[model samples]
Target: MTADARPWTAPVAAGPVTATVRLPGSKSMTARAVVLSALADSPAEILRPLRARDTTLMADGLRALGTRIDTSDPERWTIEPGALRGPATIDVGLAGTVMRFAPPVAALAAGTVTFDGDPHARNRPLRPIIDALRTLGADIDASPSGGLPLVVRGTGTLPGGPAVIDASASSQFVSGLLLSAPRFAKGLTLRHEGPPVPSAPHLRMTTHMLRAAGAVVDESEPDRWVVEPGPTQGRVWTIEPDLSGAAPFFAAALVTGGSVTLGGWPRDSWQPVDTLTGLLTALGAEVTQNDDGLTVRGTGVLHGIDADLSEVSELTPVLAALAALADSPSSLRGVAHIRGHETDRIAALARELNKVGAGIVEHPDGLDITPRPLHAASFETYADHRMAHAAAVLGLAVEGIRLTDVACTSKTLPEFPELWAGLVTGS
Candidate 1:
């Protein structure tokens, strides 16, 4: 569902975003919720599940594999798990949600199931978890480089074995193991044996969701988690709004001199949006809360902040947008995991922001962006949805910004352009 195909765009100084926007459900939560609900025996109801392309793909893929899913409502879904029949072929189509989460979820199916996806999905490294699942008696195989186009023959030949899995690169691997623990012949115990793993909060999110769906999770040690295998008892689950997706607007409220309200955002969310409220406040923004939402108003020239976003790395683009208007340099750390995204985000930011006349430096772990005068230009999103969404937010701070492949945001936000239109009160 791509929108607005104009020849090109010159970035315009964005009007203060004062609209009361209701952000979408967490794609992360939505995808995992679908898998958990599908793995159970009873009917499952998920409220406010993300309905964007990635999550919808998860639902469709699971349904194609013989599970019953009803997603007639944009905000919710009903998942019914039952008998698995036939050798199923499923396509996830660049949806990391379907690719990473579905494989383990598919292990629960009784017949042979083959998983294939688009080029980007095929490129992501899945060897660590694949190796771990193989250790636990899963019959799965990947290409020579552990790329996708994976083939998983079903549970009939399921093995019961144990091995340590390295989760240093991405948390999805760990979450996959945790989500499908019950299906494994013998429940899996993972050993984290590298630099502290990335996206720890997302890992926590998955574990918390699994427990909510009725799984036993053990994290008795600092770097280890042991999951006991059992069926997820179907129940009610609610997906929280994505704090990552709301970061750009929150930054807009801090620098654009107006209040922006976001509804359905919780006072207590694992998401990083509210945590940055202090950072926004420190940057000269006034924040207030109401019954249904939180609002922000900017007072003056924004100031830079020092922060760490290891678990909240999705906020990088928004932080970069604010740094462009701040008085000093902004430094953020714990972002090495971004390389696993559609594009190497650090490199993409350094390259693309430079096109807009910003002085930015890329680090192996994070980025250093210093505020500078802005220039108008078209930027490449490199087919990365986050990169595309980030470019649009940066457009708010300055003028003359065009993002190519803007449709990429469909991975999580298909109507971002429309949402922005509403936020800016533009047609």
Candidate 2:
């Protein structure tokens, strides 16, 4: 999915740079919505399913399982619930959600289901899920590395017992477990026994999706939870705009002293959008929200401060980009979970930022970025979506930025560059 990137150099727009850009639906929430809707026994309405590659792949996977979903409109989905009475084979097309979330959803089927994903997704690790399912009486056959190209043969008689899965790797591991908990005969009890669950709010979103579809969830602690069995009731569901997806724009507002209004944002969201707002405000951004999306305006000068982001690792790259312009040194803490994302985000950010002008310190978990006037430079985006995006935005504060083969954003936002063009020179 690498495309020859058109070389772009960021110029300080002497003229006030201003524009209202349209953002995409949240990939995280959209993927969760698809899964929950598939579990519904009746046709469920999913408003504003993201049209990006990830959600499209998920919708396709569900369709292969005989879940009829109407994808005619980009803004809504009508999901017809059904089952995959395999021998069935489906492809996830490079989406982490499908690779991480599909195993257990398939476990509810009465036959063998072969699941595969995109080339990059094929590299994502799945040992935790495989181990957890094995503990829950699921028979899964996959490569020894515990990667993709998975084969799951459901017993259709799983007596769900105690499951203590280590989620130090990915929160999706815990979410996959929670999504499938309702299908088990004996219900579910889970323990997140490794590093604290990274992206913990995603778990909240997962359980929220499950409960909305009809199930009982009891979250006893940050590390443990119990679920009462229930099949999805398949009600009409609505999808809120992605707050995580909105982080970059919010940070953009903070970086250039520019202002942007975000619409379609959710007031009650597990996404760390609100948290990012506090960080921006701390650094001198004026933020406000109403029925529209959050509106953020940046001040000319920003001061560095201490903050932890282990819970919202996906937003780290954009934060790192913003930190480079802060007056003092800024450190992003609690990011060890970044090691397991689409790429080693901590290392990717540190390496790429250093390529231009910023002084960066890389930790196993997080990074520290210092203020610098960015000069024109070429960069490799590491085929990571966030890396491509955060780097481009960083370039906006510089003389210019030239990104090479930077088309990986298609994994989430297919039209990212087109949107960026409007922001740069106001095309």
Candidate 3:
């Protein structure tokens, strides 16, 4: 079941699924922490980091650039700073973190570091980060196509200064710049232009991590960030549980009229996906926080909702799946940028949902999902983890649903199939 190469039948819950799920650490935080550790002056320890495809890819990418990272313990990473020497090749594996975050670090290498990823990753947004790095004095050749199969020729160091970029497509562009800004000789002052950036919480997460690493960052101005040039100080980092990865389990409760509790749910968090707590409540689930964690109990009544998921577009697939089974229509908007994700989420959702007999419309930036009786079908994952999660949630209510590439969930939650199987069946 861990292998995604073959199709896996999505298990149907016989009744309400009641279980306490313990999620892995945040992939977003793990990737960032790895980057920060590599940039630091001394060795640092990252505890409870997610050990999954995406995060492992990031660790491998950093090692390619001459950073010494120890992965002996899957739960902890020991990073030792080293002189960066490249002529290295990084396989991004459709991980947005590896594709977007590594390039900035590559700019500090002495030689050329080439970046490529899965076929689907070639189509995702890479231009903004490449263009922004070029603007800030990094020698990068992306063939002007600005997608992938790119190279960064590091001059040992960069003279970073004021630069302007459009990050409407992916906030990773802005975060990539900020994360590496401190290594620049002159630091950086980046201003964002064009449409408003999606996933503001992620951007904030970057800033918070940077500050925690002893880097000076200023975000007093809208769409502007200022980072002071300096060496990053090493420190121990503890990654929190991934709220985004918990989406499917929560949706399982609502779908099967069950109850589930998530351990290690942060009392205060910048994770945009934490908004799911409210969304679940609005969907006729009772939510309460206890010493154990966050518990959600479904009353067997699911209600459709109108929600703008622009800031937390990662939740779109599962939410869309839930909406398809709701009592009324639901409109999910402000996530056009997701079109450039691992796959075109909006189109994929509509196409796959309709294949199973749901009335879902793809919009310029969102979806309009109308409640319809859903039947089992072979749900295609498109190699995107969230898409796999959607199929799993829908499968709880609709039997005989075979998820093509359930292995894709390993991108974030490596034990997804095992964890999911346990949650529904109490195995």
Candidate 4:
């Protein structure tokens, strides 16, 4: 069970699994809150922040920029915003949030902040954030090849006025800009022009958090946001359970002909996976939400669903796995941008599913899955957490399915294998 050392065989369910799975803090919300807290005018407290590889890197990056983060209790952090000064280096690993979000903050530091990551991390998009920062008057030096191994010359200030960026590659580009925009002299008015930003709900999450922290954000117009600059107020921020991380567990209900309950489901929230409840319902699962949380029960009959997961692209892998196990066909559309995620999700999903004897067609933008008798096979996780999640969900029904690099789930859900084992065994 060591990290990055072994390929684990996913366990198969016997009859029906009945368990309540508690997930860790939200990766999306944790990253955003940490970045915003670091940029706040005063120290702030974050309760239940995710202590995973990605979020830890973000905290380290902020600390490198002279933010005093007290992680004595890793879940509860009291972050004291200090004068931004960094003649330091940040290892972003493969976390897009750390790579994209930290740079803008680094742009406002007193000294240079050098950023790099794993070899694969260097291939993820950074030019959009780099170009946008340069447009907003921040001095940066980067390789001609596009990403990573770059230095931000932080003179401790940024002249952020108006800028336009093509955020179609990743919405993190837009959120990164706005997260650090309040520190700029003129605030910021940003316009995103492209073939629609993928994960639109993430942008809305950014807007909500910004507004909650006392930043004036106007997203009234299409593809444009206006933020009036002022000192960001620090407050007590509470992190939520990651709904995207809860996806595989909820899906376990369907694949095993069982029931799964997830605690702490937000009554009203902008997390993209809130839409998943309806998706589960359409796929022949009884979904219920109440004061306790959300519960999903499978009737042993799963139907395929045609879904537009562009706004909640992270859920695509788990959904695709379910589609492969359904009685009919499923079409998932509007997520071409996902090809640029942790891995080329479309290609990876198609290849891996087919290896296990399922029918999945990789489209330019999404996937078309037709149910087939899936056989046991080794599922390769391309170092993608969701990829591992998909395989784990499938393994619930199909035996002899070994998942390689299962430790990649540490990117968000650090205790994934252990938690999944507990759920499967109900011990």
Each candidate's clash count: 4, 8, 1, 0
Q: After superposition, how far is residue 323 of candidate 2 from its true place, in Å?
A: 1.2
| lDDT of model number 1 | 0.75
Lowest summed lDDT over 10 consecutive residues: which window, candidate 4? 1-10
List residue ranges in candidate 2 displaced over 4 A. 1-15
Q: Model 2 over residues 1-427: C-alpha lDDT tens digits? A: 3545444443444433455655777788788878877776677887776788778878887776678889998877888877656677878776678887777877877788898865666667789888888898888898878877889897555778688888887899988888878778888998888667778778888887787778899996768889887676877666666676667667666777788777766677656666778887887788887777678887776778678886778888877887887889998989887776677788878888898889998888788888887777776676777877787667667765777645677778777777666665678
- TM-score of each model, paired residue for residue: 0.93, 0.94, 0.97, 0.98
Predicted structure 1, TM vs. truth: 0.93
Return the clash pairs for model 4, or none.
none
Q: What value does the lDDT take at residue 406 in candidate 1?
A: 68
Q: Encode model 1's per-residue lDDT on 38-149: one tens digit a residue.
A: 8876899999977888887888888877889999987668889867543887888777667778877666667777888766767777888788777777688789878687
lDDT of each: 0.75, 0.76, 0.90, 0.90
Residue ranges of candidate 3 with Cα displaced over 4 Å? 1-4
The model with the greater TM-score, 1 or 3, is 3
lDDT of 4 at 332: 94
Flag regions of model 4 displaced more than 4 Å: 1-3
Q: Write the per-residue lDDT of candidate 4 for residues 255-340, one digit (tens) a residue.
A: 88899988877787668655788899899899988877889999899999999988889999999999999999999998898888
Question: How accurate locally is residue 200 in candidate 1, as Cα lDDT from 0 to 100?
Answer: 78
Alpha carbon deviation, residue 46, candidate 2 (Å)? 0.6
